[model samples]
Target: MPRTKGNHEARRRDVSEAVWRVLVAHGFGGLTMRAVAAELDATTGLLTHYFPAKRDLVAYALDLLERRSASRPRRAAGKGLSAVRAALLDILPLTDEATDSNRIWVSSWDAALANPELSDDYARKYAKSREKLRDLVAAAQQLGELPDGDPARIAAGAQSFVLGLVVQALFDPPAFPSHRQAELLDDYLATLNSPPSSGGDHEILS
Candidate 1:
């Protein structure tokens, strides 16, 4: 008898779980077919049936990461700068799970930078994230919570700050614990409240 759609979906979920385990344990560099097979306690043939090539598996893994990130719980919805702060905090590696996810993302950078298609894909993802942040920044400015400036530029700066902090926290967790990360983020946000310098609104390249 032919398998039902539910069966196919269950099998895919199983595969995705196995892939996530492998990614969290060893990053993309160690995401071999054998490793995933062992993680799933299944044969390589099974994986090959789902992913004919290693690249296919890698692509699926990346997609899984994006899906998981999008589904993560967000802080209570608010408006203006408070909402912006909540959104930015969600990106920081302040929890164990967030730290692991950040590690996986940082590990994927090498693979993404090497392949043109993956590079473009990552670029688009970052752009989309920045766009969301830009909207928040614009709202905050409108509410007088932040000083006037180009929302896109402000958003880009915020994104860069969060990402840089993520890298630092990943590399030196001892130096940048969760509280420290939050404190630093608050400090950065505080600066946004300052009026633009007399010279002019400082140019911030997006």
Candidate 2:
């Protein structure tokens, strides 16, 4: 029987996710329609039905990641600083799932070096991500949980830190354990408070 449009759409998502899994597990080279078909238990033609070209499929998967990741911070905003930290950390490739994403993402980043066309997508995602981090850092400062540095700069630095951790995880997954990261984060928080030993400079480094 022919599937309805809704069923087809659901199946399309299933195929897309399957492609994502293959891309992460293997590499961009592994994201052939055959792989997605194997994962979805569908025919190779089925993937072509949804994404006529391999490039289209790649773009769709990348956009899906961008949108899914973009929503993490906004939802965490209501929960405040702790929530922000949790949400922002989600971007780091710490866990298996994040590592999977990073596998594909770093590949995409490398691809961008040779393909200027893909670089546009990278820039767009980067801008949106930095803005989200900026908002989180600004919120932390407002709550007195962070020092009153330039929020944008702090955001950039925090993003840099997470990026470093992600790259480190690619080589050594246990390098930046979450507990230690949290300890360092807390240490930074400590600096935000007025040093009783020093004069009255609540903002730290005063």
Candidate 3:
């Protein structure tokens, strides 16, 4: 039977999803084409028709993960610090789905270490993500929910904290449960949301 372009693309999408499942089940180390094929109950030959190399399959899986991360539903939480908090919470591994995504993301960091292209791409992505966090902090300050501070520094610190928290949540889920992570994040943000200082130069954290 002749394969149409539409069918081919559909098959590629299925293969990519299988890759995601493999990643979720076994992390990056288990994302081989054969493993994905096994997850799909298909053959390696079929996957090879879509992804010639393992790197291509891995890259496509990462791209799909990023798209899924961006498409998560986010609440407005009104304006001011609440808005910033809402945005930050949306990035955490709060849900089962989010936990899987975070696990894959953490595993991908190691994979990216050997793949310069993926590393550079993620570097840009992380920077953009941090910029959004920075903007949220600045917006909260402008709305008088937070004290005046270097928005860039605040955002950078927040980003660093979130990254570390995510790792802990992934590996030590018992200790850093979702609610605990939220409590810590909210508590830290609360410290920054003090009454605006007269000097207008208060640091984000003491």
How many residue pairs clash (N, CA or C atoms closer than 3 angstroms) in each of the candidate models, in the order given?
Answer: 0, 0, 0
Give every collision pair in model 2: none
Full-model lDDT for every candidate: 0.93, 0.69, 0.84
lDDT of 3 by residue, 1-206 (tens): 57899987887777777888898999888889889889889989978877899888877888888888888678767787887788778778998988988899998898888878878988998899889888888888898888888988888888888888899999888998999999999988987776655653666455
TM-score-sorted candidate list, best first: 1, 3, 2
Per-residue C-alpha lDDT of model 1 across residues 85-120, encoded as one tens digit per residue: 999999999999899888999999999999999899
Identify the runs in model 1 with alpha carbons over 4 angstroms from their true place: 1-8, 197-206
Off by over 4 Å in 2: 71-84, 184-206
Please give the TM-score that candidate 1 achieves against the real structure: 0.90
- Cα shift from native, residue 69, model 1 (Å): 1.1
Give me the runs in candidate 3 sitting further than 4 Å from their true place.
Answer: 1-10, 195-206
- Mind giving the per-residue lDDT tens digits that candidate 2 earns over 55-126? 887777777766656553333345446755765567666566667777777766766666777788678777
State the weakest 10-residue window (summed lDDT) of model 2.
71-80
lDDT of 1 at 47: 89
- Is 1 or 2 the stronger prediction by lDDT? 1
